[model samples]
Target: MGGNHTQIDFILLGITDSPCLQTPLFVLFLLIYIVTQVGNVGIIILVRVSPSLHTPMYFFLTHFAFTDICYSTVISPRMLADLLSEDKTISFTGCMMQLLTFAFFAISECHLLAMMAYDRHIAICHPLLYVTIISSRVCWQLVASSYLFAFLTAITCTWCTFGGSFCGPNSTDHFCELFPVLKLVCSDTHSSEMLIFAFITFNAVGAIVVIFLSYMSIIHTVLRMCSAQRRARAFHTCASHLMAVSMYFGTGFFMYLQPPSSHRSLDKVASIFYAVLIPMLNPFIYSLRNRVVMGSLVKCGRRIFSCWQHRSFLSSRTRTVHLK
Candidate 1:
């Protein structure tokens, strides 16, 4: 019944409330967050610096890694802090902002993965036309469109979910998510819920459909390939992306597709899977099996080592010259 909802703060009852589990949970998430940042950032840096990674595939991959970094940052820090601190209060403005940013990146990533799948399809199916089909301009356009769509969708969802009376409890069982925040609204949320469901379906399910179709074509093409070695290479190239897609889409669908009434404690687990675990795992998923990425990492490491050695040698030479 408050007009100034902005002045109110919502207490986020994070993953666990047990006093004994707090410290251990904090340490676990802290490590996950650290690895998520380091791994995703490493991908971005390698793609930017390595000439071998300057292709359309890597271009999409670089943006995907950046998205993962952003998506994790939106949720992890607050969640990690809440795990340690007794007060898990998030201001209304902060909560809405988090929802907005999180939705934007999350939706963008869904579309980005779809785009990457299309890229792979083109590369595998029509190798010669891959360059012409997915040109630099087209890549930029695809990425921009993904972000634009995500931003508009985020604004709509955030507004629809929060543009109502909030007379209920100021505490949510999970993070500042659509369903949790909606539970606090005093107004009839049927329209907002329907609208959000449509958007989630469009973003998540739609992306899955696109990825599915693309991979189907890719598989058909690979299966028809005359060279067994080429077919093996094609499958290898796709394996990492497919793995990432399965995990991200699986957790996302599990979290969002259920009836709000059916949202159980497992919703939190699903949330953590897509929001925290997926980002941390994406780097390894994409890079570990990727020969190009692995080779680039080695090259980058050597370059860094050589630069450090050169700096040390220069410092020693300067000391000798000063003594002479």
Candidate 2:
């Protein structure tokens, strides 16, 4: 892979080498990236402006959407640039920074999803205490702790991975990722690999366990309800979250849990799904199926139209009076 170089200054990403495929891939991901940004931004705005959605659930969703926006921004723009550029190279520092930022946001998102599941559990299983249990102070603490933990994890992973010798092939099979980057290291990586595997497993399994326990409690409470409508509403409220969680964790687990050589192509596809497609899908997944969000969107649209009409009417009246 390397001729005589002992250390590398730049890493190349071999996403695809086909000349014919470059433009198509660029357009496709460009569109997806645009939709991802707009959709996530819309979710943030919708949650902010809708008083009916000022509940703890939407509060969690707003933060979730924000995280999606952030990580997507970090990864997609660079990938899109590489698709169009002849040399798909990243500086060592750039790659390290990307890894750090991507890991932090992604890990924070996992904790946030777990917290959301717990919020749903409390909301459905103990409705009366939902507000008291998920107060503003409590919500802030949960979010803050998640972020802090993720930051620390990212630092540890980044430090361990970059501390090794990296004299192998500078080209990565897919975009810059933990496993792909780790594979490029020429030094003994057993300790780094073990640390990464443990860290990822701990975070993923912990979040999954929290989600499982919360959902189990929710199901039991839901089963005890006498009213069909209440049960349906509860299930409906959770459906979006379950979908988002599944897509995020399922793809992430599949991508990271295995060795890179066993499924390089498959892992790349999975990475694209979670990094690009999932972010674009999240706002729709959460908002489209939700009656409250739809209602708020409709209401917001009508208010904007009414205000435009009023402004037009006032402008016309003023012009006529001045002319006469």
Candidate 3:
């Protein structure tokens, strides 16, 4: 299979096969992708420029936005192209690369969410030690570790998946997802399937456990607070994160936790939820719910407008001088 494998290309069936649905789906997803990029990139830029957002919380958030951008990019452009193109073909190497990059960012996001939860837990549960616990060095280390672990896991999964022979059909129902691609493998896939299952379960469940415990402690801490103002403040700080985590893990568990034999056509819908919808929603979830981010956005907007006005005035003066 060596020589043949290098030349093989997989046909991705994409979200729908209906001719009528393609244009509308393309428009809808194109808008979503555009918003995903603008929103995530806006968050990154806001955090970078706003000193108020230079805290450990926003630090983690910037990385989270970046991860969303990356994984969303991995899926959306190709999916959009496939919607318009008659040939929905992706090279074998391209498919594997897509899987690897997407897995890396997606797994990184899981860990990043856990880290954000822990940051909130520290902020609310032990406010006195929050600064000490989540210092700059600690934040860097946590972010680095998350990416490192995700990369290792992604590479391992990719290797396991592509190591198997693919002499049979080269078409998959969805994008280059683990299970869908695995279905195309002609070799005995028991070991690969088991390995992928173990890794996915460990990543999802492990992150969820961390988030669960963190929020549980946070709940306990918030309940015991003597001041209602402090309690409301704590909940407000966590609300956006809770929404994001719920949407992410909820869709993730639905997509990956089931048996390969039980994977339905609905899995494609679930994939769209996490891979596309969640990323587009995350920036809004955080920014709209967050007073600090919203304030920063307003300030940035004013600055941009002020600069534009100044440039227009200067240009008008130049025109007047030339007319004279």
Give model 2's TM-score versus the native structure: 0.95
Per the 3 Å backbone cut-off, how many clashing residue pairs does candidate 1 have? 0
The C-alpha local distance difference test score for the whole of candidate 3 amounts to: 0.92
Worst 10 residues of 2 by lDDT: 1-10
Question: How many clashes show up in model 3?
Answer: 0
Stretches of candidate 1 exceeding 4 Å from the true structure: 1-7, 317-324
- What's the distance in Å from true for residue 209, model 2? 0.4
lDDT of 1 by residue, 193-278 (tens): 88998988888877888899999999999999999999999999999999988898888888788877788887888898889999
Q: Give the residue spans of candidate 2 off by over 4 A.
A: 1-7
Question: TM-score for all predictions?
Answer: 0.95, 0.95, 0.94
Q: Which 10 successive residues of model 1 have the least lDDT summed?
A: 1-10
TM-score of candidate 3 relative to the true fold? 0.94
What are the lDDT scores of the predictions, listed in order?
A: 0.90, 0.87, 0.92
Q: For each predicted model, how many residue pairs clash, with residues at least 3 apart or on different chains? A: 0, 0, 0
Tens digits of per-residue lDDT, candidate 3, 89-142, equal 999899999999999999999999999999999998898998999999999999
